[model samples]
Target: MLTYTPAVQHAQPPASERPWLLLLLAFVWLWPGVFAHDLWAPMEPQLLTVIEQWRNGGHWALPTLFDRPYWEAAPVYVWLGAASQAVFSPWLLDAYEAVRLVNVGLMAIGFCCIGGAARQFLGRRFGRTAVLVLIGCPGLLMPAHLMSTIPLLFTGAAMCFYGLSLAKARVIMASLMLGGGWVLLALSGSLLLSLSLMLLGACLPLSPHWRYRRYYLVLPTALLWAWPQMLLWPYALYQADTAAFFSWWQQQALMPFGGFGQIQFDFSLWYYLKNLLWFAFPAWPLAIWSASRLRLADSDWGILGMAWLALLGFLLAVSPLQFQDLLVILLPPLAVFGAAKLDALRRGAAAFLNWFGIMTFGLLALFLWLGFAAMNYGWPLKLAERAVYFSPYYQTDVDYFPILVACVFTPLWLWAITRQHVRGRQAVTNWAAGITLSWSLLLTLFLPWLDAAKSQRPVVQQMQKAFDADAVRRLQAGQECVSVEAGNHTARIAWQQYGWLTLDVDNPHCRYRLVRRSPQATTPAAGWQELWAGARPREKREWLALWQRLPAKPTEPAKTLQ
Candidate 1:
């Protein structure tokens, strides 16, 4: 018989060495980018638009964008965002910033749940190690701080994993967690993903490592708790608005299976596989090393992690891939597996990772600082010129506060790497700290420039200026509604929110029309005089144009007199 010993059976560390302080610092590092910038284009603005619709007396059960029901996902994140805005907008925060606070809370929950799961499986210290592994991932950085449902999805997965970890010992608690996690997954808006996870839960007993009788409680508890909670939202939505509910149901039912017919199967399969190279980063290599040290049937945690990873990887391979979706679902199991046997990692591999992190982040920090200097002081004329080339409208303004913060972060990172003994866990810790430092530098030292490139506020302002000039010429006062044609959700949201312009895209009576097009594209249907044309400073191929309808040239007076 092959004997298996759990890592938790090893000797415990002293209380002083607990990771509370490090976890706290990691969380603090996550705070800067969340609140320090304007809502960026593409995703953030789209989410904000939905929350705005909810807050502006739209149906609470249905998240709408531009007064139409948006069923791309469930309304859980939107509901939280709306609540956050309502709570914080009254006092000190902008609506967008307030809404983003949800990301922070969700991320914290995810970290804690992952840590808890890791502790149950590996040991106390490995819990912290797992969290650090997750924190160190390059892929987790952006999604963890974004205002989206991704964090919710991540937290839900973590909760389920933690529940699975508890199944051998704490059956009732595990049942609760499994049930709650299933509901959370459902709420995060992918029914297929939620059901896949549920299927994993069901098959837990089939694994030789998880054949405990208590494991049977998981599926029953999930059915009792999760099924009803999952149905509750749809039922409530149905009662509130039947049409909106049907739209949501149709989308939920069709989205996963429907897109397969259109997608390139080969490309879709390779997408996540290739992205895993950079996305999971250091964690994936560590996970591979950790997996090599264990047998599949030896540890329950191993079986669970491997099964979860396989299931999620398969899902990503077959489905249309979004980086956020892949990152949130895959990172937890990767983190757990990565940290499972760090102490057993070969010395050469640990040292390589240690030095690699130091060298990589050190060079990246140096480059970022150089760019910062170039943008502010014109020290490197070439870099300065390149910066201007990227964002021509960006003005160089030196804010000493961010500079001071960057300076502190750099020295602190150096101190951390130098002070740590180059063991496996310590190496991972250094990597996590380096990631935090680099992200901090980007958010702080480079935020203004990045905001200049990414934010649509400037574009909206330029349009406002043009609209004002038009108003002056026409002797018209007050804000006029603009009809948008072929414009994206980002532009529409930015214009309406920042410019305070009423948008009625369907109203033919509106005199002003805003259109988005390629730079080379001709005017959209003539009879309209161009009033404004502009794009974001960093946008190269596409631009927005405002057009005013010309009055019908007085109808030529009916062919004159006899």
Candidate 2:
């Protein structure tokens, strides 16, 4: 067995060489803020809605989405999301920030682990290169957003991988990592559980320790870790009927049909390859040549590479659901490969890589410019008028940003071919990688400005205006803590963010009050009022009638017994 130490310790870079590492670290921390100004908005409406239902003495049963009973989504994420809200009851900022911040922290930890672990498995120089590729990979960069659980999922997996590297040391510790990882996967859902366990079993050699020891500690620890979450699983299941509980996952699986499926297949598969090429850009040809130069049979890192590829293949094959973000799981291993190939590049192979890196940045800048130009200057004008200011002949559309960005690197690519005639290559490759890193930093930082130009819906802003704390408190103080009726999810978000007692809706939460808003219904208790408004005639009439019948606000507080 081979032993490895930290890269910083074994091969310390000069003080001047530290800027790239610092830049990567800084971006890792700030990346989430770029794409998502209101990171929690998309999830808040559903989760807060469910939480309000639970607080109203509702049974924790089938999950609900947008107020309707939704089953397929496992309760783990919902539970955690609600817990964050619960802790900071009556104020959502803390809870919202907590979930997003945790994810950001997790991404940083995962990146560092990949770098350190790669150094141990590969070599110091290769590990450094791997770290650079890991940071710069578009596949890894885009999904740092907090809306998804991929960050958590990747962090858990990284922990397991890094721990496996330590198996020769205390078996208990290594097994603990594996166990914790499996618990996370299980909580995530059956799909993740199946995939993770399959990979672990395939990659790991079955130890006599696990098989023979009646005193084994790993399994027990895992059970202990999972017990709390699993306790809620049965309750949720009992509450959900046969058809309602599995609906969310089924919906997720089926959503890939038609045009979306074709787009996903192309982007998820080809993008991963393209992302790798861009990460190493000007250095790519030499890296590829270097890779071709080596025989895998002699490479110590070969098994790890194969394992990484296998996991990626398995994920894509089995996921009835797929997205570009899901491909992040493949990044660490690819980083290792890229780094190793870079290490193999000779000193003469430089000019090509440098020019390539420069062009990569130049292209990225152009994309950024076009995205703005279309949104502000182009879209506002009539089509013919817009053509006067832009390249009208091609019917140039802004959505072609991806293609244009890809094209921008054409110059570096041309220079790369011509570099075969040049003698000095070392200076070029290093300068190119450095400049590319700078471009990545600038592009990511400027992402926030670009988001303003995109015409994405303002979901968070709408919620911010809709939630009213005082109204929610009055409602909670006046009515039953839980109420189930139409418009519960909307009510729940209003209540939870404002500290109202949860009224039951057939949301993710269990206990709910039954309320009817029809015209024939009796008057509401004091302080009760109808809040929903829409264009539907009958529902609108019902809401108006409910508004008139709402019970008067209570003036006196109810006495409580000690």
Candidate 3:
């Protein structure tokens, strides 16, 4: 065992002291009620309905909504969320909160893992600082606010870093983490880029040294991670859903979009560099300056760091989907280089970066004030009154103006602070602290109303009300009068909550049933009486005349089809 030296022991920071402050900020930003509940929440309920079915000793057939089973994607996330909810809380509220909490927790774990790996390479303080930067990274920050794939992506990346770090250890454990990391990545999205990195790590010319033994272990682990998709390939082929692009990556022939081969790109090849400037924010300038100095160092680890950056650059250039989140994988190596550079800087360089960060935030504050208070609160509202312009896909100048300004000002901020002077380190520290504090406070105030509007409250309420209505309950007792709410809105709510069991003529579940609008329309089998017809709230006035009559009583619970 490696003995824990006082020096090393001192090097490891206490959890509270080691940037737990960032966790609070992260929790605030990522917490629900601040952002529109993630669009993926509906998908969770869909998964839970299936899990509930299975728990009742039902078989593992895929779940159906609108009478169609959704079978293409893997069931891991849903199962995990459902099982977690079941364990923690039997209440619906508990179930919803559990999924959100677990996702947030996983992301926090990812940050910790990232910090740990950085500590291994860059000493303790710098590692935590890097994590702090990542927490505030605008690209990561926005996604972290949602309950989508970002948390899982963070977890998988952390796993890969950990596994690679362990390469200097015994083979079996390293293989498992490495394999597990790739599996997680596959679940989130493509594994091509990560697989390439691992392959390069394994096949480097420096093999045969003790240090390189870990390299060989990576290949077998990658092979293991790929087993699930490999096994599914035949079925996917028969289904005409083969992942042909991934298989053809080695052919060296570019596909419809530019690439090294059959691999296609959604954006142009230079996307990574473009997104990096915007996504990285204030830290990017520091990263570039740090990289420039490191390039001239000629040290072994410095060379390795450069190699990692080079690989990152290459992958970004070749990737099909050049989204900002992909640049996250670059943080680990960047952290190392950043720590080294920061350690070398006198107080002046640190101060400059700090001031740069502050100016960036100050500019963001001004932009938001003008865009929202001046434009959205003033001019846009007046226009909205005349035009009645509110749609789910609505975009405004206010929505993107700050993002544009952030993109342009970020580089200039870096440029102004390029020179080194170690004297201002204290000022730099104060500047960073202020940025983090201001962001947290501002978001706390700004997010709630936006989140409320974004939430599924109106939709959830309508469904809850309809299901709880006397008419709905009476139908559950097996009468024959059924009225489909006007428009497909209620049908959507019904299908999401009850799946195939819902019976409304407008709904596919009720497609085969005869739909009578009112008491005057039709007489049912004996014991069935038409009930008052009701339409969706917004459509009620338009359908008022048609819905003026009594509603129908439902029949014996309809036989449910698979």
Candidate 4:
């Protein structure tokens, strides 16, 4: 509570009380992205394993990625997807949509949290401004849609923001909200972030009237709310792993700099400045100006915003994987200051922003349209050749339904922009609408080609067809020795979902086994028959082959892949 001088005058009006319109708008903008493409490879399969574990009543804490125990982080983030999946599987919605919808919901709540925080100290108008900042920001496009840890972690950050904002009017509410939010933030693979937030709340400046509720009044209440974190994470950590587990665990979530294998920072100021130039977009400039203008004011709002922005910078500089994990946390806090900055802007600069949005997204949309045309019609031979070069398996078939849908959308977006040109709120509206329009075009126009190029589902299905019939029949007849792809997360998931194998019911060795690697990679051990081989045509690096045990063969054939 850094109430060094007095509260900022901008917050005289209450924080945003009405949040529905923004939520609805965000939904309309974001909903399609959730369903556009299949769960991507490399990461989603690993996350899905945890949800599968939770659904199957496995070790709740030690979620396995294939069949081996995976200890990247506790399964705190997976719990949401698991619960949603359990409630709506093979019934009301699809397995994928169920979890994706949960992510969208979290992102929506994050908007509200950011909006609420802005409203608390910056006034009601600024609350909406904060939302526009997030809505218009570039960093959130993919993370907001996917069923990854980032969306939930970001939502938890927003909740903490809201709780922190509630301090002046409702002490009890602030305490509970802040405490619960911190617990979730920590549980969602952000232990250090939670600790810092907890410390921030403890040190926040309070008005003279609000001083009585500072330590003696708020600490106990906050602790009660925060204490559940102990029951949830620390206790589970010990119970789930022995001393041996720490080796793999250290490489993952337990590491201070949380990268997959090692910590690597892109420490160049120019690198972040480049990211800020576009990633934070209009908001980054606004936040900077706000900081400059508010530098001398020791108001709680100014102090808090600077602190949060500074912390985001620190995290980006320090995190093992910069720009990826921390962007969601960065957007909301910056949005509050951004909102203030946007409000203070003159009409000319605002109009310039509107034009920038128009031309930028307009050109990008034109490029996508051109690409879509080249894919379907091949009039532009060079463009088509380039597309095919990247995605060799891409088959171009023009679907009229989406084309018609996009045709209808194009006019509507144009009309909306024309109206915004006449209206007072030009900057954020134009920016957000442009981004949405461009995004929608991509989703509607190019999604099928992307799926064809990227979806591992087809490859998985083909592998299922090649599964040795004799081995499968033996399994059905209660025989042993089913194949396992030891420590191979993708192969394990592909086989389990599309073939008859699981980590739980079988061991690693058997008559049949799976290996996922490049063609030049190692073959299976002695006495194995190469039955089938396949690779993602778009990505040559992803290669897989099946091997069958041939213990009784008179002579062992040289190791080979089909």
RMSD of each: 5.1, 14.3, 12.9, 8.0
Which parts of model 1 have CA positions greater than 4 angstroms off? 1-18, 258-267, 321-324, 467-481, 486-488, 522-524, 551-562
| Candidates by TM-score, descending order | 1, 4, 3, 2
Q: How would you encode candidate 4's per-residue C-alpha lDDT over 66-103 as one tens digit per residue?
A: 44666553467677778888888759767777777777
TM-score of every candidate relative to the true structure = 0.91, 0.55, 0.60, 0.81
Clashes in each model (backbone N, CA, C under 3 Å)? 0, 25, 27, 7
Indicate whether candidate 2 or candidate 3 has the larger TM-score: 3
Distance from true location, Cα of 3 in model 1, Å:
35
When 2 and 4 are scored with lDDT, the better candidate is: 4
Candidate 3's residue-wise lDDT over 260-328, tens digit each?
Answer: 445564544467778877676545665665777665344434544556667756766766654666677
CA deviation > 4 Å runs, candidate 4 = 1-24, 205-216, 240-274, 377-379, 395-405, 420-424, 462-484, 499-513, 519-533, 538-542, 546-562
**Candidate 1 local lDDT, 1-562, one digit each (tens):** 9999767664434333746758665765678777667788557888888887788887767777776777663588888888888888959888878888888988888888898999999887888889889888888778778776778888888988988888878878898887888888777655666788888977867877777677876668657877888887778789888976666666553345432223232236666777788888778998988878887558888888888988877777666434535556888888988998887777687789899999999999998999999988897999999998887767787789988989888888898789534678878888888888889999888899888888887788778788566674542443456777534666667766777565666567778888877877766667888888889875668888888888887655567678
Candidate order (lDDT):
1, 4, 3, 2
Better of 1 and 3 by lDDT: 1
